[model samples]
Target: MNALAAQALISARRALHQRGELAVRVAFYAIILVIFSALWSAAAGANGGSISGYDAHSLLWYVAAAEGSVIATKPRMIESIGWDISSGAIVTEMLRPASVVGLRLAAELGEALVRLVCSLAVGGVIVWLYVGQPPSAAGIALFVPASFLAVGCNLAAQHAFAGAAFWLRDARSTWFLYQKLVFLLGGMLLPLEFLPTALADVARALPFASMAYVPARLASGHVEPWLLLVQAAWLAGLLACAGGVFWAGERRLEVVGG
Candidate 1:
């Protein structure tokens, strides 16, 4: 690899590992899992021990899988992109021989990998203890590729959203709306299975499902091998689309004020 790529990788790794962020992030995931488990337990007791084919244990496990998958990835690439723009660092970035987009992409991937390792190590143990046995060996094996696809799709989506910063200058509203949609459509709060048929159909067709739902479903043994292939295809397609958007945004770039 070239020096710029190497430097970007190093920077990404440093950013992820700095100030014990990995530990803090893992703790956050664990705390969320605890809260989710308690809520599920309370709901199960009130509802006579089942809600939508999942008891407290299964629900907790599902939440754990979802949380782990989410915490494992870097979802704040847009915010970073925005900060880079606002700070005028982007001007210097654009002057580099390397592709700014490519550098950011590599950095984000490195950061995501670091986060994924920390989450799986800490969060996996918590899930096993409270939720149940960890996903089976086969399920764990499947999660490797499933997670790669999921994170790729998620980063692509996030970068595409961040690219809007180039045009909007202040994209807080857009980012908030996009995040809320992800929470709902990505099945982070509830599995798509529980949604109305029409909504669930839409969710499945969108890229959001590949982020949390597909991997979580695979972790829970709810998906078929064929479905895994479909998720991979979605990841590829989303990445391509994100790349196109980033390129177009770069071409249209106008740096305001310094």
Candidate 2:
């Protein structure tokens, strides 16, 4: 555990050294939020300034929070792990003291957490300009844990998907499919409440909601603490699944001489 934490910190520090890259990423994140916020405002104005209980102001805040919590703007874990496995790099990582997947996850989380904070800071200011206020203090405070849970669930899912590389030699296609799921089912663009009732119910029952919607809702001032419980449940299950898949992949690689 200490080793994993140390690796995470090291990776985060390394990521910070890429200042120019980080600047571009943060700028792009801001641009996306601004554009989407404007579109939402226009749509809301055309529809009496509120849709599904979200006014233009509220929608902008929601978009800000949601996009901030996401927008990593780095290599997705699926591609990274896929590359490692395909290039025979996993062989060296397998010899490390920590579990391969755990180590990779820690490093990814470290960098992602740093990026998330930076993106959210910029995004928060943009939304504040739009709405004339920041998210509620309670909302901002609870968003911390909610965002962590969201990242946990997301990374676990990606790890599980990457395990397919043990056989397919590339998981990038899976990553693409997962991105769409996050954009829609994960509620990156809008709240799941806007979806049809039956579809919303199904989406909630799935693991995607725990990835983005749960944190975004919390950040947008929906202080339902129980939402974190659901996120936690999904995180636990996804983590287990990721572990199982990666372990199986490791076995396959070992037997097949990757």
Candidate 3:
């Protein structure tokens, strides 16, 4: 446990050391928030009122929350797993006493914490500057846990996708497609409430929604305590699936060359 914690801290420190990368991502986060605020404002005007119960202010807050979740999520675990599997570097870790998935997840959590802070800072500032009202106290309380679970869910999902490297030479394309699905269906760019009723229901049923949509919804004052249960269930399921994939993959793993 202590070793895992140490590894997490080291990984987080390493992630924070990439200050240039963080700055660029923060800049992009601000840009996207501004652009979406403008677009949603226009859409609200055309609709003659709020769209799906979201006025311009709430909509901007929604965008900020959604974008902040994405910014906070670091999906590098997929690429790292895929590369390790392909290069046979994972074999070394497999021989260790600690579980590879556990270590990687711990590390990812550390790295994600740093990004989450940076993202929320940027998004919160923008929301404050534009909307001028703080999110509901209850909403903030609920959102923090939901957002953390969302990050964990994403990491588990990516690890599962990374396991595909055992069968496919590279899993980058799968990861890419999965990410796009999250971006679209998970309410990263647009809230699920704005979607057609059927589509929104489907999104809610899927784990992707738990990743971004649920947290954003909570932050926007949609108080649904049940959503946290849904997120927890999805996170558990994803972890089980990912664990199974890695367990099976490791048993059949082979290294051909030095």
Best by TM-score: 2
What is residue 139's positional error in candidate 1, in angstroms? 2.8
In candidate 3, list every pair of residues with a backbone clash. none
Task: Put down candidate 1 lDDT per residue, 26-63, tens digits, no spaces.
Answer: 88888897888788789877999987776776676667
In angstroms, how far off is 47's CA in candidate 2?
1.2
Worst 10 residues of 2 by lDDT: 68-77
Backbone clash numbers for all candidates listed: 0, 0, 0
Please provide TM-scores, in order, for all candidate models, with all chains considered together. Answer: 0.87, 0.95, 0.93
Candidate 3: lDDT over CA atoms?
A: 0.82
Query: Model 1 reaches what TM-score against the true structure?
Result: 0.87
Error of model 2, residue 30, in angstroms: 0.4
How good is model 2 by TM-score? Answer: 0.95
**Order of models, best lDDT first:** 2, 3, 1
Selected candidate, larger TM-score, 1 vs 3: 3
Pick by lDDT: 1 or 2, better one: 2
Give per-model CA RMSD.
2.7, 1.5, 2.0
lDDT of 3 by residue, 1-258 (tens): 587799889978987999998888888889998899889989998998588888787788778877787677665557767888888888898878887788877888788878887888888888889877655768777988988888888888888888889767586656678887888799988999878999988988888998888888888877788889999999999999888888778777743331
